[model samples]
Target: MRIAFPSTEKLGLDSPVYAHFGSAPYFVIVDADGGDVETVENKDLHHLHGNCQPLRALGGISVDAVVVGGIGRGALTKLNQEGIVAYRAVEGSVSENLALIKNDGLPRFNIDQTCQGHGRNGECIH
Candidate 1:
């Protein structure tokens, strides 16, 4: 399965996961079966609060799922419509999250769980 993780830097699997999907600058795409990895820049990083475009941020590369610290309802809906599941990421690097995915440890983000606002430290205030 191909999994995408939103990251703040281009550290590959060691990259720290960004707090918000739409605002992340890079993405670490991991191929679980083949053990291949790819990093891509977010094409659509700047937008209004409710206008995040998941496909555009991913550079149109198809993936089975996305791992993020937070995501808005609109972006989550868009990803779901494209058959991509969004999982709530733990507070760690992409490598940690990848391991969690293998064990089905991450929780799928329901619409209500989506980010409604940002916290004082920039975490999801949902």
Candidate 2:
């Protein structure tokens, strides 16, 4: 499976996962079965609206799924439409979160719960 995780850095799987998909400087693409990983910059994505563009950007990569800390309802819906399952991963570095997703497929992506308490921190809201 080709899994893409929004990240701030390109230092392998240990890169930090970004809170918002759009603002993520680059996306870390991992070929789970092949164990190959690479980073792709999001210059083509317009993330300010927090809408479907990031999902579209991901679609271009042919990613099978997206694992992230949180995503808005609109983005989530679009991702689902594109056949990409959304997994809610919270409070972990990039590698750890991706490993969790690989070990357990489609874990409960509770956007509401994981995105809570984050509003105060000025991060993206679900």
Candidate 3:
């Protein structure tokens, strides 16, 4: 499966996962089966709070799923509608998360679990 991870840097699989998907500066996309990787700039990086255009931010890249530490209800809804599943990210780099993915360790974010906003520490406030 191909998974897109919101990253704070453009360090390929070694990039640390960003706290919020829409606010991430880069997206490191990895092809799980083949190990192909691509990093793209998040086009909508500066979007207003609660108004994340994920598709635009991802530069319209096609992928099976997205892994993020936090995401808003609207963004999650949009991704679900597009047949893209959003998995909650663990505290680690993209490479670490990939290993967990092999064992289905990450959890999916439901609407109620979505962030209403971000805290000062960049953590999602649900």
Candidate with maximal lDDT: 1
Error of 1 at 104 (Å): 0.8
Q: Give the alpha carbon lDDT tens digit for every residue of 15-109 in model 1.
A: 99888998898999999889999999998988777888889989889999999999999999999999999999999999999999899999999
Tell me each candidate's RMSD, in Å, in order: 1.1, 3.0, 0.9
Clash pairs detected, candidate 1: none
TM-score of 2: 0.80
Where does model 3 exceed 4 Å of error? none
Residue-level lDDT of model 3, residues 45-100, one tens digit each, is 99998889989998989888999999999899999999999999898999999999
Q: Specify the highest-TM-score model's number.
A: 3
Query: Which residue pairs clash in candidate 3?
Result: none
Which candidate, 1 or 2, would have the higher TM-score against the true structure? 1
Question: How displaced is residue 80 in candidate 1, in Å?
Answer: 0.4
Kindly list the per-residue Cα lDDT of model 2 for residues 1-126, writing each as its tens digit. 988888878877888877866556788888888988988887636645544475556547888877877766666667777788778766667678877877894475544543422365447764
Of the two candidates 1 and 2, the one with more favorable lDDT, higher being better, is 1
Ordered by lDDT, highest first, the candidates read 1, 3, 2
